[model samples]
Target chain A: MSVQDDLETVEWDVSEDAHITVDNEQCITCEDKPCLHLCPAECFDYQEDQEGGIYFAYEPCVECGACMVFCANDPDKGAVSWSKAEGGKGVEFDFG
Target chain B: MTDVAFDVVVVGAGRAGVAAAYKLADEGFEVALVERAKQPGMKNVTGGVLYGSILDDLVPEFPEEAPLERHVVEHNIKLLHGDAEVSIGYRDLELREEPNYTLILGKFDRWFVDRAVEKGVTFLSETTVQDVTQEESRAVVHTDRENGDIACDAVIGADGVNTTVGRKTGIQRTMRNEDMALSVKKVIDVGRKTIDQRFNLDSDEGAAYIYTGFPQGAATIGYFIYTFDEYISVGAVGGLETLRWLGDEGYGETGTPLYSLLEDFMELDNVRPYVQGDAVEEYQGILVPEHSYDTLPDRHDRRVALVGDAAGLVLNKGYTFRGLDYGIKSGLVAAEAVMECAEDGDWDAFGRRYDTSLEDSYVLQDMKQHRHLPKFLKNERMYDAYPGIATETLRRMYSAETDASGLTWRQAYRAFRRSDAGVLDLLKDGYRGLRSL
Candidate 1:
């Protein structure tokens, strides 16, 4: 493998269930959403879906739990659940 | 079993293992160093600050050949409260001269391993040590994914924080939840010009910043910015217990996860400007043992010895982030003990000597000295009240208000005492700080 290719495969085996999931219904319509503002991986996204409701995706999540800690509304209580992804899955950084 | 014994066998060719192998080989001892990774540093992760004193000790004139990033010239501490920030910092040209602290170590493990190989230490890469078969006189290290068992008089386990050798030999217990700090880091590819300008550093000079207080809260959160050749490494670390505490308390509004906290920290108006044109090249998360004096495990068994993170020797004070240095130093000490035992022909005496050396060394002393500091940092007021007070006080002092308000510095201080802390609480905290330090 090329040096770059070899570097690309230095994957960390994250659990399959290791990710942060958010319940859109529980999102409070606040002027400033701290979760959207604070995530290091830019995992949280806000957009108008086809039906006009705000759509959110956390595909790039690193599972650091900053949103759950800073969430003004209680997300961990009911709105969001954070858990380790299935073993050998999640974002793998080659250069880190 | 065929007789293929070496004077010493060091497992896991990370910083600690490499250092020990180098020292022993240089001292004319037959050493066999084994690594499970494809290369020396393939499985290693470091915050990437090569502290000057340790490097100077290992190789007195190291700068000429070391893969150094930049000589650090500035150090900053930021206390964040909501949207406001209180910063205390120092910049000196002296730190950029000879014996200067350098932001290096991307290829440090490989370089160190090469040095050991040069000194006649056999480098065995892509070899995994399955278990140690202990006999009365010597230990035979069994290997899978490799050919045969290699016997050695003594073994040194430097296999980072999540050590398999330490666990298999029962030299130390598995790390508890509170004893480990989960850290995530990223290398953002901001060009050299952008990095120099954004961090206010000159050519070949770098800056480092540490943050505490709001956003990070009572948790031990530290963000470091180190200059690479063409990128900047930004990273944060927090205790797992504190992370669990925050999760239970229900904090984020939009359901921010712990790993994403770094993004939030970087996106802050205060931090965003530095990386305006940068692109993230990598992101990684690793566990760091907090090196609490209480959590230190006994160093030796009948034939095995634990060194580096296996013995729980990571030090993370607010001002200094040192792990590689401790790892190297402990490995050197362990090697010396093993060498002493080889001379005396007493394995039991060797094990005792290793433990005694650790207790007498500066590594153990430093950990014991700062034993109480970690608990003091866990205090919520230090993150919440102190940062809020300091920031508000600075704001009032610097405010360009035309209105002639009769607020003296003392009165301004009292107004900023809007924190939940009272005089007695402050006094008790003061005492704790003094005692801990």
Candidate 2:
């Protein structure tokens, strides 16, 4: 098959389980959400909670460990923790 | 029916296969080189850098006739975080001379294949080897698109990472997904003047850059800007597992998400200028075999021998991107082993000789030496903490404020500490990085 045809016919699937997590209760009123800036996939979404606190969405995480590595020393608030989702349960790429 | 046979049959017409055929033919062995592609390079993929030293050994004065893009004059390594970037790089004029390192080879596979053909090696294109018809002594090859079988004394499987010959011969059972790297690249057309001025290069020099840090995740992303006459070959490579992980998290996996990531990077007020207005002429993706030394299959089995990615010889460390050279070198070594076996009239000892020679050569030594690099690169901190901390540190160092007293370097250290990476962790990472080299 032609390269273009082969690429068009390929399919991609994503898993439902989230690999990145954030503890909402411990967060402080930090002005900048560092996780948002460091994420390679830009997976995190920062929004105001009902109590005027920052809420995060951890979907679309590439699991490159940027958040956890950068947030390890935060004394006031725990930013993020990362782990492998599950074996044989993540993304599948036909082109790659 | 006519009976046609050779002393050696080299499959796949790629860098490895062509090199093997050329070397064997040069040593007075009748060689038949088979290729499945419409042309030698039509189905081939490469990063387009022909590490000059490797080619010079194979064919002297190669730079004179080789389709080289430009001699690399600059090398840039960047740690990127959000809109901030921390870069350390070098430029050298020594690489621009006669034995220059050129960013070339859009059609390198074909070029090598032609050289092999010129050296009395038979070229059979548009033909695929379906299977090997083995006898007690010799083997005959069956082609899918050809009418007759071609028998040979030995067969070399240089068919790349997904080698059917290697699979059929049971030399390699399968290649694991983690053992591969997924890369997306594009040949971009920007005016020569634009490329030279933007990258701080003259018309004859090329530049390559690698970025590791948050923007690339724990996964390493390398961008190369090889100067062609009026275009630049730019791209990124990351672990296949990392790409899949991102895809599983609901980001599209067919390169659109990665393209979006690149867009986000370029949109950053700092990075937008370098790639602005460059038209992407071609976009392609390839799988780089990144299996550790433990994953490498046996070099030989009876009449069959594996070379190149089929043998799992790809090195992705920081110093070099070296699969093609490995392919060429291994191909030559395999041919030499076969020549020795031919001289001895001992077909059974061919496999052992090939393996021992490979172990003795730099091909195996390099892989064995850097076997830990893949795991080290896979460390999350390499992608996560370092980029952000470095970029933030650069920002603090570079920014100018008019009214207030400047913050002390101690404050800068505090900012780095505030980023959550400690001195001990940095030292550990440094040791691991050093060990990888």
lDDT tens digits, residue span B232-323, model 1: 87777777545544533223332324455666777889877865543556665566787568767666776777788777788877766767
Candidate 1: regions farther than 4 A off:
A1-96, B1-3, B97-104, B247-256, B401-409
lDDT of 2 by residue, B1-437 (tens): 21688998998887788889988887888999987655565445566455566667668857777666678777777766655677778887876763545443336666777888888899987666767655788878777554657888888988776666776677775444466665555566788998889888878788776666635465655554455667766556665445544532232222223444455554557555676654656555555677777776666887888898778788877645778778888888889889888888987677678888989989889888888887777777777677676656556666664222356565467566886678898898899888878
What value does the lDDT take at residue B179 in candidate 2? 61
Tens-place lDDT digits, model 1, residues A1-96: 112222243354443443566666655444334444444444555665512232455555544444443442243323455433332244443344
Kindly report the docking quality category of candidate 1. incorrect
Docking class of 2: incorrect
Candidate closest to the true structure, highest lDDT:
1
lDDT of 1 at B381: 81
A1-96, model 2: which lDDT tens digit per residue?
Answer: 122332332222334756556765555554444444334445555555522254555444333343443343355435565443332333222111
TM value for model 2? 0.76
Full-model lDDT for every candidate: 0.67, 0.65
Checking candidate 2 for backbone clashes, the offending pairs are A64-B218, A66-B384, B69-B104
